[model samples]
Target: MNAISDTGAAGFLARFAAMQGRLPGDSTLRLAAANAFRSLGLPGATRGRRVEAWKYTSLQALGGMSFRAGAATAPAAKGIVFVDGRFQSGTEKNFARFADRADFGELSWPDRDPMAALNTMLAEDGAIFQIPAGIDAGLVHLTHIGTDGASAHPRQTIRLGAGARMTLIETMSGSGCYLHNPVTEAHVADGALLTHIRIQADAPAAFHLATLYVAVAAGGTYDGFTLNTGARLTRTEIHASLNGPGAVAHLNGAQLLSGSQHADFTSVARHAAPKGTSRQTVKNVLAGQSRGVFQGRIEVARGAQGTDGYQMNRALLLSPDAEIDTKPELEIFADDVKCSHGATIGELDAEQIFYLRSRGIPDSEARAMLVRAFLAEALDPVTNDTARELLEDAVARWWEGQAA
Candidate 1:
């Protein structure tokens, strides 16, 4: 099989079909993936509105742009860039926790091309960050910049070895008319702890789609916080699997939408082993004619006793034109497990505003304060004070502009 011949749409379909034969030898999984791709290949007219709970932030409004290959510019910092599914050489840094050549070499799939798997399974070119065993480290920053008129798909993979601890910070910003499709996969080994923070501030003409997948081993911990403030259309998905007993996962996210922009945050947490726990909180502020969506699901497998999970999603509509849709779900097969989910959508509290105004606070300032307070909950879990402060500042700046 000539893998290079599989480029573009036809190439993708052929390669995907070939890879389907080699995947875990699971016919059901192959059919599921094929069906997913077939659904994805439909025309806009046929697809129309999205029926998925997490797809309330529609990408169809962005017109007919599809993911294509292109050249990515030189990154300003230490990170990999993939333009149109091609990898570009980035500057090697001594300070950055880099993935060595051996790391890439070890990722081999028998009877299947790794590169093809990466291209078909992943949506973009991405870098990998690995925290070796016994390495307790500080934050590692990942910055993604998208130039105008180019579509880029980047995929990232991170692995944390036993007893390792680290923080990952991602900042995605771009301008011009383009699409950024990114996917990230993370593995937290036994006794490892990982803190992840993401910031998305793309241009108004940009369409961004991101998915993060995480696997936690026994005694591992995974914590994440995300803030999305830009892009005409953006969707972020986080999926985590608790594969080991005593694993823990926590997720927090906030989206600030204005103008005609749309943002969606969807997450799924699955507990496959005993004594695992997960919690998630999501917040959204919608103004102007913008829209936001939050769909979260927690699943506890049968016989996975001692599993605990909780999820909450809340939205604030600042204008009559603003809209929000939320769906919180739980699928528990274990009778001994505990799982719950809650969702709320409403306007600001009128009584609180009146009380603030009576206290001599200007209406604008009072409103901004209330909004800030509402957003602070998501920022509470950020371990890096600088990152937390930066997020706070960004929220404040956006709210101030809204007030003005």
Candidate 2:
């Protein structure tokens, strides 16, 4: 390592030193990432420096603990499966392993992000997806499972050629206490389309930190949605760049949190070219002592004339102890852009519940109905029947827990 590290970071660096030779990538890149991690350390780990990007959340629980690799198991899945952090099995074509191929991709900035640097130094395996031009891959599934006490880092790449179309359904779930850190990069060529739906259902005692970077070219689209309902601590960060004229990007999601759970959804959308559009809407339902955070930022470059961007974040609190924090920002250098952002935080309307009760509905059922109605708008873009069903089922289970 190039510099001193904190205790928690020292533990990870020690593991990297013990296992660097075994990691299946170019040693130089991994070493550089290690040095980066050594210098950056974990956010809020020691309070030496503050990272505004991580102002609303902390990795205290993950940094102080030690985790081992999880056992891999073979489960029947249509597309691909990752056990722990390795590519255990897959039934899909046009795919490869990151460990076997060593494809780090071009979109991520490990030097700038601590978690990305950590993943870069320790990732053992991942998946590579490629869709050929003019081909329509209707649907595919990606699953991640981490058994007890595991620390897994998986790095993946996704590419869609011109005029290609694909829908990706991602499911993340595990058992016991573990940490799942995955970084993904996606490139959409001209006229390509990619639809992504992520369902994160980790164990209640687990930690999940995920980051995604996407670049969309002219006439291309990247439509994505996330549903987060599990984990003791979770943060999902996304960066989407509209690099060419007429490009479109949508980052939408919802968080259903209860108990002492903490979840953060942060996103940045940049319009780098003229005539680009970006949209985001995130909803949160908090119960018990849960806490939810949303941070959304939009940037319009000086040359990005005719840019259109909009974002809205809303939160519903079921109990007095529940809390929500929201920050919506727009940084535009273009005069010809139409950009706007807003946030709303409140509890369920008592009059609305009363109206529903007058129609012969129970109070719990009435509140549930209103919550579902609020989430329906955020889920409207998920048109795939299978993906929507998965999200619906997860939401239902979370609701059941709150009711109980």
Candidate 3:
């Protein structure tokens, strides 16, 4: 805890003070988070010091903008929806509003992460879903809609009983110049399986900052994927902990950035027990003056022998001005663990484009086809049909905008 910026911290704390009475959950926890937020402030926004976690991204602009808690309206949909973090539509058997039951869960560390602290301090509403033992929840749709000039902090919680299975699809889409900060905590019990797919397509001028924490027990599997192609500045951070033997985790994602957009995907996978396995594969495609970032780390505990972990980051620069940053780290205390990490950064192959062009295809179409081929291999891991179609449509729209 060090000195932080008054301009950013003061305004944020002030908002909390005004709404302290109306907010739910235990007041003691929220107050503690508020104290931490005041101490940490916005990373790189203050002039005093900087932290390594936020080395590639800055919250200076977000700290300066004063967003409102204005009302929002979302288009009618068949799935559950939240407008500015408040419940709006749809229903499920085991679903409830965060505003109704605001338990912050036991996984997050607001005292260490400033963004998590902010969300803990001021989160108003979110989705809370649960699954019974041995039951299979086929598919769950959760969507968030934002409005202009407003800010929303939503806290989501999902828990699965032993032998249960679930597939969750989440989307964030809106039209605004607002800010959306959400924190999610997921619990996977022994012999359970959870697949989480996220698509973030916020308004062009909006800002998005999200954090997710997951815990997997013995014989459990946590499969996660994210597609980001919207917002002016976005950062999605994930932390996964394997707490029992034979637990598995798969963290895979793709980022398509264009114009002056900036997106960062940071993740940490920790194996605390023996025979745990984790794998991560990330792909980035950038055009114009866009910038993309990927930072991933794998940690194996002292007794966590026989751990198998591997991660790879690859980026394709579509324009000379496009930029990408990659950082991969592996920390192991056990001698029998097998872990490896690597990164590749390059532009598209001109020969491939020319080969297709010589076959009488237009230059733009040929280039698009090659790019699709590049993304095809990465999207293979996603087995859900609806999720696959959603990713394809999002990629197509992004490419169309870039070509225009």
lDDT of each candidate versus the true structure: 0.70, 0.89, 0.89
| Candidate 3 lDDT tens digits, 1-404 | 22223346576788788788889998999999999998888887756568788899988887676666646777876589999878899999888889999879999999988889999998999999889989898899999888997778999999999989988999888886878899999999999999999999899899889999999999999999988989999999999999989999988999999899999999999999999999899999998899999999999999999999999999999999999999999988999999999999988788988899999999988988888887887788899898888888888887787877
TM-score of each: 0.81, 0.96, 0.96
Model 2 alpha-carbon drift over 4 Å, by segment: 1-7
**What lDDT score goes with residue 220 in model 2?**
96
TM-score of 2: 0.96
Candidate 1 off by > 4 Å: 1-39, 42-57, 66-68, 72-124
Better of 1 and 2 by lDDT: 2
Clashes of 1: 9
Worst ten in a row by lDDT for model 2: 1-10
Off by over 4 Å in 3: 1-7
Better of 1 and 3 by TM-score: 3
Report the error of model 1 at residue 129, Å: 1.5
Model 3: lowest-lDDT 10 consecutive positions: 1-10
**Per-residue alpha-carbon lDDT of candidate 1 for residues 1-404, written as tens digits (9 for 90 to 100):** 43435333334455456545443333453454444544453213135334454345544444344333445564555454433334544543322212222122122221132122333342323566767897986666677777776656555678888988888777777668666666667789999999888888877788777767789999999988889998888878777899999899987889999998888888889999998999898889999999888888998998779998989988989989998888888898888887888988888899999999999999988887788888887677776886887688878877777877
